[model samples]
Target: MKALVYEGARSVSVKNVPDARIERPTDVLVSVTTTNICGSDLHMYEGRAGMESGRILGHENMGEVVAIGEGVDKVRVGDMVCLPFNISCGFCRNCEAGKTAYCLTTNSDPLTAGAAYGFAGMGSHSGGQAELLNVPYGDHNCLVLPEEAQERQSDYVMLSDIFPTGWHATELAGLQPGESIVIYGAGPVGLMAALSAQLKSAAQVMVVDRHPDRLALAEEIGAIPIDDTLGSPIDQVNQLTNGAGADRGCECVGYQAHDPQGDEHPNLTLNNLVHSVRFTGGIGVVGIFLPQDPHSPDRLYREGEGEVAFDFGLHWFKGQTMGTGQCNVKAYNRLLCGLIEQGRAAPSWIVSHELPLEQAPQGYRHFDDREPGWTKVLLHPEESG
Candidate 1:
């Protein structure tokens, strides 16, 4: 099997790896058709996530089930399915409570509660950035796609991560129909947040970012683009919201946020959201914040153990509420998939490149560098079957 293997910081290469096969009775084997290089993958690609060398690197995956274990009763061979990045057991207490992202039975580390494919500190499960992938708890993890899935892989593949994650931000922020919302960052997840706001009937949707291409995508979806490079994003949001601030704000930039001069400021977006959102309003944080970043040049991040200089005082004084965590993708993928099948959602609009599996390293390089027009990249592994 061919896979995009993580070699080191800012490095990846297509290498021949051992074939992926059913390892348990509840597992299924998928012939990966489409997989994405997600923003999360950059954490590992840049050596900030402590990802091991030779590990396959992909989580946003969808494909044809080539084989199914005897214990797998629901998912069958030949079924087209999208696997959520979270590898859950479905019977854990957290899973029962609709918190599949924190499933207690997946990760071997007693200190950790969740597990994900091809992610550092998540689990040993290999990712689907290859010709074959082994899916455990097949019936539980595999989201069977609609009849048109073969023709719409680009959109359906998003159900694996960003789309649901973006939707999760809104849910956490308690967005109500007709309420205005502002989302920070115009990356894939942030753009999806803007799109999700529109689909949920937000009266006003504002997206903040310095990238013209990304902000343009948000504006194309009817979101007001706030270019932080030209002026204060908070002031821009205030102007759009008649000085009351937005009803809600979402932090989608995570710890990698920086100023226009390209200096890392982990607290930039969080503090901005505290002020950009109205008094007594809500804030949702869907950006990936690690427990620690030893590679970070910021002394606070490197020494204070990932603690950002957040505006908690302002947050409390404003009487704002907040929610933060990974998205429970299973809770939303089904409904979002229905919307896709009905022609109501098209997440593929953000896809900027599609390449063969061998070219995954190039895709990763361009996307990680934030190259213009390289918003998203999808990879197709050549079928061996």
Candidate 2:
């Protein structure tokens, strides 16, 4: 099978790789149909996040089940499914508590509590950016796609990661009806946060980003767009909120945040979010952050990593609350999927390009550069069925 293999800092290529098959009694083999090239994948692509060479590099995946182990009973061959980025055993204590991201059973990284696919410090699960994937705990990890799966792959695929991730971000921030919210970063996740905020009936939705194209999309969705490139998003939010700041703020940029000059600075977005919300407001951080980077200051193309100089004093003085981590995608996907099925939310609006699997390398380049009008890119490894 041909898979997108990580080749080092800022490098990837399509290469022949071993075929995927069910490896455990609980496993399911999926013929991947649509997979996404997410910003999280860029962390590995830019070497800010580490992965072994030859690792397949996609996590947001949706496909049709090709085979299932004898133990698998909930899902079967020919069923359309979306695999959550966080692989978990539904029977784990943590999973029972709805903390699927930190599932005690599936994520144990030999030394830690939880793991995720295609991520550094996570488990060694191969990604779905290829023709096939072996899904462990398949009965729990795969969400059955609605009957409209064929017509809505673009939107349904998002249920695997960013859509739920963005929704989870807002949920973490405790967004309420009629409240105002501001989200940093106009990336796919950030845009989904904006859309989620709208779905929650936020009185005002504001999105901050330097990219004109993303800001425009925010505008199209009735979100007030703030160009952080022009001035402090803090100031813009202050004016929008009459100096009290927004009711809540979201940090969607994660560790790859940047400054006005495009210098990699993870803390910049956090700092902006700190000052953009109200005194007692809360902030939700869905962007990826790591404790250490092996390639920084040495790698030629390190993206979005640096000492995060945050305003601890302000955050402390304001009595603000903060929630940060990878979104436990399963936590919110079921509800979001129902919304999509009812046409109440169309997260697919953010998808800017869809290409065949062979075009993945080019898609990566365009998305990594945040090329004008390129908000989200979806890759299909196989045509319908």
lDDT tens readout by residue for model 2, 1-385? 8788889988888888999988899999999999999998888888777678878888999999999999998898999999999988888787898888888877555556566767766788888888999999999999998889878999999999999998999988999999999999888999999999999999999998889989988999899999987887889889999999999999898766678886876577788888888899999999887766755542322433434668989999998999988788888888989999999998888889998888899999999988898889999888422
Model 1 stretches with alpha carbons more than 4 Å out: 383-385
Q: Residue 91: error of model 1 in Å? A: 0.3
Error of 2 at 294 (Å): 3.2
Question: Candidate 1, clashing residue pairs?
Answer: none
Alpha-carbon local distance difference test for all models: 0.93, 0.86
How many residue pairs clash in each candidate at the backbone level?
0, 2
TM values, all candidates? 0.99, 0.95
Winning candidate number (TM-score): 1
